[model samples]
Target chain A: MLITKDIKLADVILQNYHLIPIISRFGIKFGFGDKSVGQICTQYHIKTNFFLEIVNAFNDKDYKPYEKLKNMSLSLTVSYLLKSHYYYNKVKLPFIENLIDSLEWEGEDNLKNKNVLKKFFRQYRKEVNEHTANEETEIYPYVLELEQNYNNTGKVSVSFLEKLKTKSIKDYADTHDELNSSLLDLKNIIIKYLYPAENKDITVQILIEIFKLEKDMTDHTELEEKVVIPVAEKIETELKKRY
Target chain B: MAVKFSFLIVEKSYIIRSGLMQIISNFYETGVVNELHNVDTLLKKLSEVNADVLIINAKLIAAVPELILDIRKRFEQLKLVVFAGTRREADEFPGFDLKISVDEPKHLIVEKIQSLINEIKPKKDNNLSENLSEREKDVVKQIALGKTNKEIGEALFISPHTVITHRKNITGKLGIKTVSGLTVYAILNNLIKIEDAV
Candidate 1:
């Protein structure tokens, strides 16, 4: 059963995956849709099972899935923003456009739906680009540097991400939590109208595309919380005296 | 089945140059030569793809022993044939199917493919039981465990010099040179468990 809070995220993914029938063709594709839904669910099982795994990690607690779900949604939003350019250019545009064309939506009624889809895409594109620039330019590099130091020395200097002056580690995590809330908002908006359960080629294509996007976004969030932040915190404390 | 072979040729002469081009053309005419520029590039390529056999230039065969270890880890089943210009190079590692320049006619290189094809098992057997005597295997397991030669000798009730001699023989027979390479080989061949080594 899909968790209530995850419903919107699930809807967005299920809808997008419904749009693509080509997922089967990419069975050998190294990542993304080449991966099985079962594989995806297995990877995501930990996060969904104990939502506290994410949010509570930030707060220092045990076994919390709801908090993790919320944190994941926001962390993923920021990550999506960071990688928006690559996603739009490589994945979104080619796959979505090809998907629409494959649907044969040239007729008047279908044209109307296509126009609506285009408008929805426009908002998604703009939001994603803005988010990507914010994270890539401002956030991702800091996290990457943190990861590098932690991997090498098992610590990060306190001032590692101070260039952005985001204040304390707690502040950074709180801001991360805020990002999840925003993502939840975005997900709800997406879930309002996407319907493609007919198993039509277009529906299948959309579902696959959405599934890929959602999975990428989700994994990106998990990377930050599970790996990036904890490593950053460890390094910040270790290098605190040196700086 | 068509025999797919890869070449790890290292010549100071560029592949695009006239003499090298003629050699390449001859190989292409007589056999399928998938040429790699250098040893490092060849090993990296091995990780990304699998091949039936690798025909390495004699110079490359001797130059980067570390890379040979890497290839041995990644492509354990690859049948390696070394075409070296001198007997010294051929004598350096008898474990490889080494052929000196004067002995290696173009037809000899081509004809060797049939045997190499029969040897392409894709993944080399990592079980130490397949080769090596019981005593030699015991010394190798100790070496892989980060034990000193004296410690290995003490454990096995032999002189440190005897342990060293066994190690030299192991390196010569296995064609692996580094401690890390031996570690990888031990793990793969089941000489040592991954946890024990780690």
Candidate 2:
């Protein structure tokens, strides 16, 4: 359970099945012959520091990535975040929805109950979409603008950016934890209330998918709250100082 | 109905302050314009009164970097316009929502103010369900209630494919693709009861 830079990536994923997607996200594949975490990351051209920070953050709740993220590129971190969004929206969400659709129901109100589960999943998906869309359209553009304004050597004035209605990245951060609770509600509803009669195995599979997604989303938001927001705040401060 | 606009101006110079007030008064038929000579009084007055737009002298913003930021954070809906002697001075105060040069034409200033007023006006929800047919509304209500298309079709005596088409139209009309958002919309517009949504 101890995650260190010297530990094998395979061993880490083996210990925590939830990290399988995280490992695959970096394009790391199986069949490594005793390669260490640092070695495999270097071999695959992944940012070793960023990977380690993410792994540590995932493993230990008290671990903070502030110092490591201070030196990291915001653009790179945003790209990684965008990739995670892709996994959630395109890959994991669709897989779960399809699994739910294929489940066989049993009871007098079987159809009605199944519809409730479907509706819950759909609601969670929508909330996620809205959250990610806001980040992509509003927050990302503002951060990029802040970065650009900070780096410009000339007497460039980003007065227009300042004029925008969006006050700060912190506003977006405030809405981060709302999506997690609804997801937890979905898990509870399925497990406690709606029991699929004929296809219990499929129901279990769907629950496993939900559990994996929940972990992934938790780690993703932690990185955002810990890593991305701080970096953005630093850039905003720098931009202000430059002005 | 004519939209009411309000303005708060913070400028040090008496002549320029009154002159700017005159311009705003002449531009709009009905608006409450308050002028202050100091940032301290301006901040204090803002707490007492509600204004849609805040026009501050750029010099004050430069002297106090946190002035605009503080005002913006405090008043989430207030639009900001910095009146500066030059574009360079305006550029130095980057926190203002807009910049109007002191030497700019009066008509341009009026236009800018008008635009800012329009921008700050509370957006009309435009009755998102107005375009939805009765059938579409029923489908949305069912979706919000966590009903699948198949179940909705059975309840409404329509084909599942027709239910999907209704769903598509509902999303297109409301510009909301998610069941949760549609549920909120339904509840807000009174298309579905709050108890049914849960």
Q: Residue-pair clashes per candidate, as listed?
A: 33, 1
Angstrom error at residue A84, model 1 = 9.6
**How do the residues A166-237 of candidate 2 rate in per-residue lDDT, one tens digit apiece?**
476666745655676566545644564355458788888988988878888877887677777888887776
Task: Please give the range of 10 consecutive residues that has the lowest summed lDDT in model 2 chain B.
Answer: B121-130
- Candidate 1, A131-195: lDDT as tens digits: 65665775566655644554565544556546424533334552333333333332332233233
DockQ in order: 0.00, 0.02
Q: Place model 1 in a CAPRI quality band.
A: incorrect
Task: Show model 1 residue runs off by greater than 4 Å.
Answer: A1-89, A92-94, A101-107, A144-199, B1-198
Model 1 DockQ reads 0.00
Each model's lDDT comes to 0.51, 0.75
Report the CA-based lDDT of candidate 2 relative to the real structure.
Answer: 0.75
